[model samples]
Target chain A: MDLLAGIFTDYTLRNVALGAALLGLVGGVLGSFATLRRQSLLGDVLAHAALPGICLAFLLTGTKAPLILLLGAGLAGWLASLLMLAILRSTRLPEDSTLGVILSGFFGFGIGLLTFIQHSGDSDQAGLDKFIFGQAATVVGEDVLTMAVLGGVALLLVGLLYKEFKLLTFDPAFASSLGLPVRGLGTLLTSLTVIAVMIGLQTVGVVLMAAMLIAPAAAARQWTNRLSTMVWLSAAFGVLSGVLGAVISATRENLPTGPLVVLTASLITLFSLLLAPERGLVWDWRRTRNNRRRIRLERLLLDAHVLYNHAELTPESLAQRRRAAPARAKEELEELAARGWVTGRGERWELTEQGHAEAHRLEQAMRVLPKALNPRAEGGAGGAA
Target chain B: MSSDFVIVLTAIFVSTASALLGSFLVLRRMALMADAISHAVLPGIVLAFWVSGGERATAPALLGAAAAGLLTVTLVEWLTRTGRIKNDAAIGLVFPALFSLGVLAVSLYFRNVHLDLDAVLYGEIAYAPFNTLEAFGLNLGPESLWIMGGLTLVNLLFVLLFYKELKLSTFDAGLAAALGFLPAVLHYALMSLVSLTAVGAFQSVGAILIVAFLIIPPATAYLLTQRLPVMIALAVLVGAVSSVLGYVLAILLDASIAGMMATVAGLLFGLAWLFSPVGGVLTARNRRERQRREFAARLLLAHLAHHDRPVPAREVLEEFGWSPAFLAQAQQWAQREGLLAGDPNGLRLTARGAALAGERP
Candidate 1:
């Protein structure tokens, strides 16, 4: 308890929490559009692209002003995005390929520039290295305020253009037909995406910023179909992950904040992908199992119905009639009896009236299947199954 | 003049190499994979340095980079095959983790070593001239020329030898599979070549210039042509041009030659984006202008068709609120294009014009 108190009281921890919260808010809001546009990978590319810009800014100004560096980062990121767009539009290169090219190239350039700066013996370059992977612990109060203002503006813009964004994402042709300035909206969305990336770049660094943008929104999408709800839920999930990650990182002596936050975000995404109510893997498995049980029950009832038509339906005859293994048949019969779908009379199993009706309906449904399945059988019993 | 000539020659050599390789990459839709492979090979360089006890040994670095590049592709492929994660997510997860691991390794394990992360990240292209090689009787710059030349030859051979198979595989992998061509084998082979080329380029221009070379040239070429052969040739030309320009720019700025080269590639892409004939910004603007003209002509025709009696041209212009020159131009074009005819009183459609109007309505 005392250790926890001591950790919480630290200024660095407070700043880390503040920075992460701001990043979460901004990333969540921007990520919604990125996911919708299928440009989630753009965040990843842009993050790496910012490195050169940051290095270049420091080289030019010889100042460590966060604002200047961020501005430079934003410009570089935007330039990379533009280059990516150019590659996609002009060349036969695929979108993913262009994204990969710009990301690596810009990052490599940044590294080269950074190396040059280091070799040049700039004394002020000490802490700037941390920007590559990020140092959330170093975030200041002023940075938090800037994030809040930018995040608030981004959210407000999204709100104002919610309907337009929706229409544009789902049906671009329809939106263009309505004369909604599709090009302008696309540019706006791209700008917002860059801002979101830039905001998080300082807290999480370029390496994990893309994860922060994609993971929470992807997880939240699994829980809801409605756009607004998904956005809000994603924001909540992002905040929760960020706060939790900061706390966890604070608990450790040397663990960085970015990786922890990303791990938490990844965990949330995994959970949503595996365990969400409607679309999750678990739900799919359960549905398949239920469907198999229904099919099996229907099959059992049909077999029992056929047996009932046979003359002298004794236990021995019934045992012969059941085509499956005796142990399997016995288990299924027991289940049917438990469900009141079948009853034992004089050591012979017979379907109840309800079971008979269900079996008849199922047979009728199956009659459609053979015709649907075997289109060559026009009027034969093979067509009717 | 000598410096300029050398810069130009180097640019031509590098661009040619890059373009030759880029054609395969763009077609495979693995253009960005080049970038990923380039970055992921950092650990390979570091490992090579560690094994050799220094950066002097070229073989170790090449081996390490190739291994790392292949590993990245394998990891991405594995993650995607699981069906548990999206392709983009797999990429996001794999590259960063590997890159971070490399960074961490450099910082933690190699702190005491003479080499730094910057050396691995940026590369030393300015020192390329110092590493001399003897080929035949002449002394040539070490590795850069040989590596690029060899990769270019391999790329050309691969493309020529398996053109039909590559085309089939790239366009329709499923069809290629149905036809008994193993796309997986082809994919891996292409990735290996890309990895090799990327590693080679890393020494001359660093990773970023390699990316610029891979993407920018092909992109510019794509803007200029639709045919694959033409596009490939054009891309090579563009790449070569940018390399030369970049080198000159670097000399002028007294900056990193690789950085300047990448900047030049970017500039070329920018020029293509704005001014390319087919689908550039300027072309789009031109298309918009043509569309507006068509719209105005249609509106005028509709107005003339709607009238019960002959209307004067002046009244038509006033109703549409368009300039007289625009109205006159629209009328002239409509008439010349056979979408309209002039009666004694006013304009009417010819049989062809009526058919066109009727078809639209």
Candidate 2:
């Protein structure tokens, strides 16, 4: 308890926690759209694409202000997206390939610029390196305020455009038919994603922001069917993971905040994949096991009913005729007796009044031959022999 | 000028490799795999650096990047085959995890090391002149050029050797499977080539430029042509041109050469997207205009046919509110197409014209 108290009191811990929470809120809300559109990988591409923008911004203005860098990042990120779209539309190349090309190319350029900036030896470039892997500890009060405003704006935008986003995501053709201006709506959504990724860039950095965007929404998908519920749940999971990761990272020195946050989100996704009620592995396993058990019981009952068709056969004779193990045959007979479908006197067992009705029902259910178990026919055959 | 020539040559070599591989990637719809491979290979690079103990080492780094690239493809394939997750989700899950691992490895092992993430993301293409290789008594400064050249040759050979197989498999993978050819093997081979190209290109242009090279040129080529062979050829040309122009632009502005190159590639795609004669922005707009004109002409022709009168041109103009010039142009087109006949009295549909209108209805 004391150790926990000591860990929580640190200024770095507070800042990281606040920053991650904000990033989580934004990522979760935006990621729902990405997942729905089946463009989840776009998040990864955009995150990497932001690097060149940051490098360029710093190189041009020689300013390390977060706002300036972010604006530059946003512009570059947007351009990358445009290029991706252009490639897909103009070429016979698939959308994924186009995306791949833009993502790597832009990111590579960013890295080159960043390396140049580093080698130039500018003192003001102090915290600029943090954007690569992210340093939650570096989040100042002003940065937190910025995150809040940006996160709040993102949520508000999503709320305002919720209906259009849904229509556009589910069926663009239908949305267009309804005169909803699908292209405009698509641009709006992409813009929102870009903003969300940019906001996350401060805490998770470019390397791991995509994971934060995708993992929480993926995790939330397992828990619910409704879009609204999924969105809210994803938001909650994102915030929870972010806070948890921050706290974990705070407990130690030298642990990068981005990986911790990603790890936490990944854990939530892993949990959802394994344990969500309707679609989880455990539930599926239980369902299959129960189905197999039911099939086995039904098969045993059909066999027992066939035996009962022979006139008052002794338990021993019935077991021997079926070539059944005595103990196993006795268990089946006991189960039938417990259900009042059979009665026993000493070692002999026979179908009772209710038992006979059930036995006939079993025959009808199994569609087996009724005369196959007739003792009189068997006796006549034996006498002829 | 010599530097510009080299840059252009480099672009041609890289684009040739990227375009050849990109054709299959586009057909398979695994274009994002190339992106994933590029990012996920960082660890391999870091590992290569770590194994060689510095950035000066090239062979180990290349080997490491290749290994990482292969691992990424294998992992993605495994996750998809497990049926536990969707393909996009699988890609989303794998690359970041690996990337994060790479980042973490770099930070943990090389805390005091001079290397930074910037170097990993952006390579020093301007400084690429410093690195040279001697092959069979020939001096090739900028070893990346040779590496990319070798990979391009290998890619060309592979594609030529398996052209028929690749075409059949890409167009109809199920049929290919039924015919006893291994589509999965072809897919893996394509992925391997993408990885090799990405890693080879990464040194000179950095990761982002490599990506731009892989996607933009092919996309531009795709807009201009429908045939795969033609697309590949055109894409290579576009890539080479962009690289040359971008290098010049970079020199003029003193900007990052790779970034400028990517920008040029983007510009090319944008232009192609708008101006390509085959289903581009202009084409689509023209198609719409043509349809509107056809509709207006058909409406006028139908009105005349229904009335069985010498309909006044003024009356048709009043009903449609179209420009006189447009109406005249439409009439001329209709007449040329044999959809209408005109005498001094008025315009009427021929039997053929009536049949054409009726068929649409």
Top TM-score prediction, candidate number: 2
For candidate 1, the per-residue lDDT at A62 reads: 89
In candidate 1, stretches whose alpha carbon ends up further than 4 angstroms from where it belongs are A1-7, A48-63, A75-130, A159-167, A172-184, A240-260, A267-368, A373-385, B1-18, B42-86, B113-115, B125-153, B172-175, B199-205, B274-361
Specify the highest-DockQ model's number: 2
lDDT of 2 by residue, A282-367 (tens): 68778899999767655555566667675545566656756888776787778777778778865777777887676567667755
Clashes of 2: 15
| CA RMSD of each candidate after superposition | 9.5, 8.8
Q: Tell me chain A's TM-score in each of the predictions.
A: 0.86, 0.80
Those runs of model 2 whose alpha carbons end farther than 4 Å from true positions after fitting are A1-8, A45-94, A97-137, A157-189, A251-254, A282-385, B1-8, B48-63, B78-84, B113-115, B125-142, B286-320, B324-361
Q: Rate the local accuracy (lDDT) of all candidates.
A: 0.72, 0.76
- Model 1 chain A lowest lDDT segment of ten: A310-319
lDDT per residue, candidate 1, B301-345, as tens digits? 777666656677778877978898888778887888888878788
Per-structure clash totals for the candidates:
2, 15
Lowest-scoring 10 consecutive residues by lDDT in candidate 2 chain B? Answer: B129-138
